[model samples]
Target: MVGTAAQHFVAVHGVGHGAWVYYKVKPRMEAAGVRFTPVSLAAAGNNGKKLEEVRSLHDYTTPLLEVLAAVPAGEKVVLVGHSGGGYPAAYAMEKFPEKISVAVFVNALMPDTKNRPSYVIDEYLARTPPEAWMDTQFPTYGDPPITALVVGPKFISDSLYNLSPVEDQALGHLSVRPGSLFMEDLATMDKFSDDKFGSVRRAYIVAADDKTIPAEFQRWLIENNPVAEVKEIKGADHMPMFTQPDALCKCLLEIAQKHAA
Candidate 1:
């Protein structure tokens, strides 16, 4: 009923990725009559900002915040986050719970008030060879090493884009930038109350074949943070937008319709 006609969606891309990641899904959502806005967080994907410029959790997520703030009053939006994009979605939910009708995590990190993005990242990094898969340090910040983490192309194909088309996977490796880890920023801004973020309805779309976040970890995240519903995209890797846009779009629409006013 409420969403039977149309609904608005603001999709956020994961770490190292920019608005470009949502390219494949945007046209499909449009064809389906869903309004879609794909955003590239600061210092990410054609944003023209360098990774070194990102110094805080807020800095890393400013673009997403800007987009949410631009939403008109009394108008609610469905916030969707993929991979590392989940942190911003959660932060936005906490900051503007009233504006978000529902938050969706798509094969992404689901950090709670008690959790931090650094902790979630560490879990994934532990499973891979840091030297080979990522850039552990750069001259971005001083003293404590506030460098961004960059994913290697080899790693992307194996873990994040295994199920995607060869050309799409290549584009992913070439286009992805180094994402700000913002370990310190998240450590400080990680606190959220149940009345804020918890009050917003949440959903998770699990990439059943994800090697980046992994299906088990996605389930673990849900168990800890909890959500109203769970959907699965079978055979999808971490980048389902490219590997399974149709299914992902359908799932997103289903969530919107199920929770529509």
Candidate 2:
């Protein structure tokens, strides 16, 4: 259990997911005296913006940046990034290292400071070919052809929500939106610096049974971008908050106690 000092946690959802995905996590963390804030990036969750409106990486990360900017000067918050949310989390760490106590990548992409921000995602796509996506649509938009991923119900059920509850799977099907990879923008942007992003503490929570990002690939990510520590949740699918909420909470609480103290 965490000490009397309350730890603040800001959760960033992955592609197609909104802040609503953290509904199960919020109460559990808050009950343990942690301040939990889940944010919806542009066009995600209930955000009014259309996918077409999000033109660049900066636009997609604006909400998260705003939230970090609002944090008290002396205090820091734990930033939890799930799946593709890792991109913005890394971005935040670079932009506001002092405001973040630690960054936790939960079955998510963990980019290294040595390469462009797009490198990790590009690697991920290379590993997961179009055929492997299985019904998940990759539609390109705009003049330069920015690609957006629309996760299909079949893919969500078979991969993302395999171990989650029926109700949760239903919720995901109804709420998910098209999410951009912003590959073009990231490819041109500068790489993260060791002085900023690397200075912040990082921990990874691996969902052992995650089929979306297979165990082997997850290990590959860890090997490439080593974190301060690595924790695993046995039998957890991609959406651990739904399938393994208690276990996820335990890992998060332990991380908070160790890293945020």
Candidate 3:
């Protein structure tokens, strides 16, 4: 395990999820004397922004970028992203690599800019049948864009929260919101370069039993975009923050201590 600076830790959530997903593990970081900021992407969580308002990738990620900017120069933070949060985390690393000590992807998308945003969703849908996704809906590509993606209640428990507590699953159903897929923006974006995003050190946390991004796909991502080290926790679903908080906390602290500095 690599060691990191033990100062600040920033976390970003996946699609249809807010910072609330990290609530279970935040306390562990706090107890360890690390500063933790769990961000809600655009319209997700208590951001109060409407789904229609997130028109561009810039709007969707401004909050995360802003937080990265707030870190004092000469001081670096350990940046962590889950699922859809990985894309923005990659973008942030590209934009401000100096501020990030390390970027950690926890069962999240490991974007290379070679793969378009649509590829992420399409891959999931390709491997998973329509029934597995339940009533999850996507926006139509047209003049008046649908703007947001919404995962259904049944889909939440079935695919995402299968290993989580029943009450925690209920909280997810009640608080989930419409989220952007950023397909249009990613389609037009340039591929990440070695001098930019690839310069930053990275790590991957594999949820072995992940239903959303299966174990094979997770390894596929790791093979595509290599990381400094790889860690695994078996029986963990896509939402390990809830199902494996203690294990996740230990993994993160190890990452921060080994890779962040």
TM-scores, all candidates, are 0.91, 0.97, 0.92
* Per-residue C-alpha lDDT of model 3 across residues 1-261, encoded as one tens digit per residue: 222325788999998888899898787778777778898878888898877777766778888999999888898888999988888898888889999988999998887645654566566557766666678887654365644678888778998898889988999999888787777777666776677788899999999998888888888888877899899988799899989988888898887777775
lDDT of 1 by residue, 1-261 (tens): 123444789988988888898898888887777789998888898897887777777777888888888889998899999988888888888888988998999998887766554666666667655454542334356556686676777778777788899999889868988886676676656467689888999999999998777798899888877899999999799899988988998998889988755
lDDT of 1 at 235: 79
Residue 208 error for model 2, in Å? 0.3
Q: How high a TM-score does candidate 3 get?
A: 0.92
Query: Which run of 10 residues does model 1 get worst, by summed lDDT?
Result: 130-139
C-alpha lDDT score of every prediction, in listed order: 0.81, 0.90, 0.82
Looking at model 3, report the run of 10 residues with the lowest lDDT sum. Answer: 1-10
For all predictions, the C-alpha RMSD in Å is 2.5, 1.1, 2.3
Backbone clash pairs in model 1 (N, Cα, C under 3 Å; residues 3+ apart or in different chains), count: 0
lDDT at position 206, candidate 3: 97
- Best-fitting candidate, scored by lDDT: 2
Q: Model 2 over residues 1-261: C-alpha lDDT tens digits?
A: 542346889999999899999999888888878788999999999888998889897899899999999998999999999999988899899999999988999999888998888898888888886776888988998887888999999999988999989999999999999998788899999999999999999999999999898877888999998988899999899998999887888898898788887
